[model samples]
Target: MATVESVKTKDKKREKYIVTTMKRLFKNKLAIVGLVIVILQIILALFAPFMTAHDPAAQNLANRELPVFSDGHWLGTDNYGRDVWSRIVFGARISLVVGITAVSLGLIGGTILGLLAGYYRKLDAIIMRFVDLLFSFPGILLAMLIIAILGTSLVNVAIAISIWSIPTCARIVRGSVLSIKEKEYIMAMRSMGASDLRIMIRHILPNASAPIIVFATMRMATAILSTAALSYLGLGAQPPTPEWGAMISQGQDFMWSAPHLTIVPGIAIMLTVFAFNVLGDGLRDALDPNMDLQE
Candidate 1:
């Protein structure tokens, strides 16, 4: 009965902590704006098919470069005469998915490497040396190199970005794990004969999660921006895909004739990146243990 009561108490405390964190997060004005922007983008991505009337891929030479607010084309037509609004809406889905998927993959790989390296002193040198090898190269250059070898496709782009993300995440997780593994509770768990895996997963990981969460949030912005950059360089999402980067690439030729084509997607990428970045900043502040929380 006492064990059960203690478990329930812990659960309640966990819930309270979450609520308090959220309350602090909401108190930041910039965080609120970032949250709203991120949510808006998600809504647009989720309902992309219904958000616009015209098909993003369907082209009409007759409607080529139709100016913004023209008849049926709200944001105007691209040089291919595809609806700009439809493309942008659909592009949101691509950006968000690619960002999330790549980050998730990177996080998983990094977490495992970090946990193993931090928990086992023998493995630390080998793993960190490998991480150092990856870190030696500039991130974008490394990604571009990977894409060059993997071929120019969306899947390859995601893979490349995820690979690029691994080193940074591994370093962060390793630092957190090192700090947490030395704590008194962790030492107590070891003395109690708990399995290494159980102790690491149940205790160390949870305590280290605050920094991980912040890194993931900030990394999403980098992922989105990288996706666009690769696509613009003709190393990612192919033409006619309506990807923001590819759209910008396609629109560059018609810059003088129809500047809206490039401007619109440029703004979209900028806003999405900004949203994730400020939200990440807000999360860092909210999660800081040193910060005083208001009642």
Candidate 2:
């Protein structure tokens, strides 16, 4: 009877928390805009096939550079004469796949490392030292080095992005764990004979999750941008793939004659990064109930 009642009360608290969070998040206009933008992009990516009958790779040199919003092409054709709108719709699929997958890899791996380091003094020194070594190189440089070794491909791009991202996530999660493990609940779990792994996983991590969630959201933007940059540099998704960065790279040569190619993809990248950043900020504010929303 006591356990049943306790579970019911806990469920109620969770329900209330969800409702409050939604209310706070919706109150932020910028966040709402970001959410809408992201949702539309996701929808477009999901329905790319149905949204456009033209193949993203189908080229018609005779119709090249027809200009934006032209017949059928809508946003115009690229130097390759491929449909810009179709490529963009298709591009979103790969861009998001790479970004989300890489971030997930980093977050999962980093969170585990951080939990171990924060809970164990001996491990903390070694883990942090490795992180410090990775930090010596710039994030993009580190990603480039990894890509250089692994060679270029969609899968490799995701892996390269994860390499640098892991260190950042580790550092952030480590800090959170360091603070959370010292709290009373963690101590209580320890006193109750819970194993170190159990205590850290069940108690410390839940308390530390908010910051990790926020960091993950922001890191996603970085990952997407990095993927695009790498693609632009010819170290990411190969030619004919229509990845936004690669599209921009292809269009760079025709900048003077036809600016639409670069401008379209450029705007896509910008809006994506902007959406994630604003959404991340909104999450931070929404998660912290004490923050004054009026201002």
Candidate 3:
């Protein structure tokens, strides 16, 4: 009964914390706009087939390169007369999938490595040197190289983005761990005969999670951009995949006479990236201890 009651109390506290965080997040104007846009895209992605008015892949040679609002089409038709709006809606799935998946993988891997590097001084130099090596290449360049070696595909794009993302996450987590591991509570845990892993996982990580989450949101935006760039370069999600970058690539030739094909997808990518960035900034401000006391 006591244990169950204690668990209930903890659950209440967790719920309260979540509620407070959400309230704080929603209070920011830019965050609210970002949240709405993100939610819209997520909904579009989750129900792409049902949401699209016409088949994103179905082509009509007769209707190819139609102007925006031409006939029944809303945005316009692409080079193949595939519905631009449908492709844009469907492309949300690819962008979100690549961004969330790649960043998640990088976050998990980086957090572990960062914790190890930050906790153990003996391991710091080695791990940081490796991170330095990765940083020598920019994110897109690194992803491009990885894709070149791995081949073009959705999974490969995610892997490449993950590889490029790891170093940033690792650096953020390492910095957090370095600061957290030196806290008094950590010393108290060390004095309590607690194992290093236990202390790291239970105490250090929870304290560091705020920054990690903020970084993850920001990294997700970058990952999405990288995925689009790779697709544009013909190294991601082959033909008819409806990936935003590929969509943009396909529309480039019609840019002069019928620019809607490229413009629609380009706008979608820009809006999505902007939304994530705004949300990330808001989260950073909300989660930062220093900002908590400020207006």
Candidate 4:
């Protein structure tokens, strides 16, 4: 039986561990602020319909190109006389959808390839060589090539972004799997007659989740940026649809006359990308508690 003092000491140790983790996170002020901004953006996106008074795509030529503080339009109107603020709120949905879907596709494909390559030395050369070949090209350039072939559609944009993202995800997961597969627990599982698939799925993948999560977080920001680029190039969501990239494309023509049209969407993209990057950094630190200690 444990003594009261022993129990108290154990509780104190647990408390100290939690405090240390929180302290490390709190030290990252940018990360904290980024998290707040991300939350606000998500809230705005989720409740866009309720938050805005006008339909995002509704056109009123009479109200076209109103200034930021205009009577009916707060953030102003665009070339088509649509409310900029309304369009932006609705556009958040497109950005989030493309980012999340593209990342998910990349993560799934990369993880499978990485697991196979890392677990079987025979497969490593073929798999890693292909990944290397992809890495040789600039990511944005590769995405452009894909988009050029696939034509301009939202699904095509997600596919284009996913293709470029796969190599990075594969590399990270392969490294993690190589390290994890050699551990004692994996060896024990193998000795117990676990099949390669079972071990890879259950033991190896679970242990490698930390780095995968970090990669996913960072990849989200990359996906958003890539989607925007695709849209800018006229290879993404078409006009009359409220996408951030499309908004910017339309606003560029009126930049001098109605700077708010361009500035608001630009701010949206900058804040979103910055938020995801900071959040990713914070997650990396949080997930790997021993990283600071080792440093």
- Among these predictions, the greatest lDDT belongs to 1
Better of 1 and 3 by lDDT: 1
What shift in Å separates residue 162 of candidate 1 from its native position after superposition? Answer: 0.4
TM-score of each: 0.97, 0.95, 0.93, 0.90
Number of the candidate with higher lDDT, 1 or 2 = 1
Off by over 4 Å in 2: 292-295
Superposed Cα deviation of residue 69, candidate 1 (Å): 1.2
lDDT of 1 by residue, 1-295 (tens): 9979989999998898788789889999998899999999999999998899999999999999999999999899998889999999999999999999899999999999999999999999999999999999999999999998989998999999999999889989999999999999899989999999999899999988998999999999999999999999999999889899999998999899999999999999999999999999999988887776433
Question: In candidate 3, where is summed lDDT lowest over 10 consecutive residues?
Answer: 286-295
Clashes of 3: 0
Better of 2 and 4 by lDDT: 2
Q: For residues 39-111, what per-residue lDDT tens digits would candidate 4 score against the true structure?
A: 8888888999998999999999988899997887889999889998899888888898899999999999999
The model with the greatest TM-score is 1
For model 2, where is the 10-residue window of minimal lDDT? 286-295
Considering TM-score, where higher is better, how would the candidates rank from best to worst? 1, 2, 3, 4
The total of clashing pairs for model 1 equals 0
lDDT-wise, the better of 3 and 4 is 3
